[model samples]
Target: MFDTTTTPDSFARVFTKGRLSIGLITPLEAYPESPFPTLKDHQQAAKQAEDASFSSLWIRDVPFYDPNFGDAAQMLDPFVYAGYLAAVTERITLGTTGIVLPLREPVAVAKQALSVDQLTDGRFVLGLSTGDRPVEYPAFNIDFEDRAARYREAIEVIRTLSENHFPKAETMRFGTFSGTLDMHPKPIHGRLPIMAVGRSGQPIEWLAQNVDAWVWAVDESAAIREILSALQTSALDGRPPAYGYSTFFDLDPNPDAPYQRFYNVVRIGRKALIERLLHHRDLGVQHVALNLKPSRRSAQSVIAEMGTHVLPALEAA
Candidate 1:
């Protein structure tokens, strides 16, 4: 049984118990159906997010550009950008909206995660998943069908390395660690908070027992609540895993504009957005990363508005 009462590290604190916080996903600007974003001002924007009281900044892992996928998504390695962001920002949590676990080796994952953890002083959270893109699996020479097994094995290997030095681990897919070799710069919290992205082909019970939290796509509050309610009893050791989701949001320049739902986004004013976030908090969602790709306003403008209006409203709520 995993203990839920343990004090969370800084990264985990962004998604603290019984609280809801808002964050922005990178390439923070409004891309609007384009695969590219001008990243020259990323550092300045990140600093602004932290200063504005945004809880976290999320980076995504898209190793290669596929025409079918349509978006390159920051076009920088997530770990590299994470380290860069950690260096620039003072207190905002640096997280990977997700890194595809099966595409990379566990030892490398552990080392990179630990490096960022140490660099940020325990301000890193790893959102992990077994990737869904078939195009990438073949390019990496990994069998797509066996990704679930690899993902599970990789997690075990990472956990073993994080918790124990000179630990022996035998994995069916991730090879073996004979306790002879050990990795250094372990996570500042003994283990980094690993949030499982989507289903990753694992059962609810398994995820609840293993990962620190669950990351999902944003949906209607009622629907999201129904799903979470169903999983209430499946949590291992009677501690429900924290819930997070990615959402598309376009904050209108008009603060009083009415809410209008888009395909995957909700175009609304700050008042409506604050109400939505508060509703999600009531439904037990601890954190939500807002994707501004569909936004109508520039990232700078949106961030300013949110900082002045939306963020304060959430805090007050």
Candidate 2:
């Protein structure tokens, strides 16, 4: 049911092939290493990000707060938050940095995904993953070792149920299905564009063949180059899936703050941040989501700067 024609879905329009767009990760506040957001004025921040014309507002899928895990993500259920944000904001796409697929049933996930898609008027993008947190797997009573295989199974189920009306299939995780039952509230374009984070336990080729896009963490441009090179070699048919990368940014108070790397994050100023994003674009990144929790300034100001300076520059390029 997916539209393979020139008319792209809302998600595909913003995350266009061969172009780069910037999006903000939510709980939009200066929490640094802490999991909690001030949350008091975040509704306003969400409005601001949309006004600033960010391509999307992203939320994380953190089911629980593992004290040892340190960061609790946005501290909200992603689907719930997406539904809320979809109502609160206009025009901006609602996305998940990822939803943990192996933890939930495929039909349930499909229903929720399509619900959000309709709620947002086709502005939803599904980013699914196998989930890396060991603490979360056991908490859900799922075997950590089987997650990869289950993840692959769930992908098939989601795709099948989304595209076919009363699909017939046999699978280990989703069980057998006949043409007797069909998924309801079909996606706006008949299917939602599926993106995956990391490997999700499948080979690069498998991911390349199935998913519309792929996301990963990058500390440097070299990693992006390697991924782009690999994508060129293993892409489905001749259509290479879009590649995206995410990083934490601590925007310095100075407008001309220099770039410095810390682990997977960068503590940099707007000028430097713009330079980095353009470089990422040059490296074939279709999209990048920035987490502002590490910033010293208010999330409002960071959002404004990115909206005014960063996103515009990238869009123009």
Candidate 3:
């Protein structure tokens, strides 16, 4: 969710009301491990997403890697990498596909995120999730079982730190505060937009009550429908829109190849991928972030293909 003290002007253009956006998630490919993205590919991909006219490029925050978890999410500190990506690209918004909330203290996270937001001139949007992997929890001495509660709490703490005449509120789990502590380098817009990763068992009312937007993941068709239904119910004035989606791509790029999806990764041709996304749109997905995970000769190749073959059609879809 976003800060009440902050206004819409503080957000990226994509955060404006009833908007539509398409973005790419990085790593930008399918990998069984965490630390494997090509340094060259990562930099080029950020520019390519912008050059291709995409609205945003999202990077994942995987604080700790659990090999058993099977996916490393490109293994970089998202905020630091975001700083790098911010410097490299001009317009495309930089996002954290998500930062796992329960893995670290909220204050450290908020300070760094604010720094990135300022560096990017307010082009930061954060995706947050209550971590699900059991292995990731214990490493931080946090109970994996109750992360959902901690997740909610972390969101609250971050918001308070990001806004509120800081030195005023005594910090708890995040950090100790003495006086009105204002986070340096305020958001370009005064607030950063937050997209809740999944309901995380928190209710649609809560999602509507909190996050600036909500995300649809995995292959759940009904999930997007449910979110839209809640958006209508949660309307305060003129129906506030809630984003919905499930990321997919033409991995393998072979139409005849038997399609498969793992970790939300899908293998299909560009045409099939478009159809599935359109289906989601019809169901009320206002924004969709593509993860172009197909087994291409290169990540840039997939980005090029999406720009040339997929994006144009989706614009009309």
lDDT of each: 0.83, 0.81, 0.69
Candidate 3 lDDT by residue in tens digits, 1-317: 44335545434344433344577778765443334555546777678878987777878777766667555666778888889888999888887768888787788888888888888878888778875566777777987777777778888877877766655554445556667467766666766677887666577667777787776674567765665777768755534545755475544566445546665666776667677767766776667776654454466777777788777877665
Summing lDDT over every window of 10 consecutive residues in candidate 1, give the lowest-scoring window: 1-10
Which parts of model 1 are misplaced by more than 4 Å?
Answer: 1-5
Better of 1 and 2 by lDDT: 1
How would you encode candidate 2's per-residue C-alpha lDDT over 81-151 as one tens digit per residue?
A: 89889878888888887899989888888888999988998888888988768888888899999998998
Kindly list the per-residue Cα lDDT of model 1 for residues 264-302, writing each as its tens digit: 788898887788789888888888888888897889889
Q: What is the clash count of model 2? A: 0
Q: RMSD in angstroms, candidate 1?
A: 1.6
Q: Which candidate comes out best when scored by lDDT?
A: 1
Residue 245 C-alpha lDDT in model 3: 57
Stretches of candidate 3 exceeding 4 Å from the true structure: 1-20, 30-35, 170-179, 218-220, 235-241, 251-263, 294-297
Candidate 2 CA-lDDT value: 0.81
Task: Tell me which residue pairs clash in candidate 2.
Answer: none
Model 3 pairs whose backbones collide: 1-211, 10-189, 34-72, 166-181, 167-179, 167-180, 167-181, 251-294, 252-295
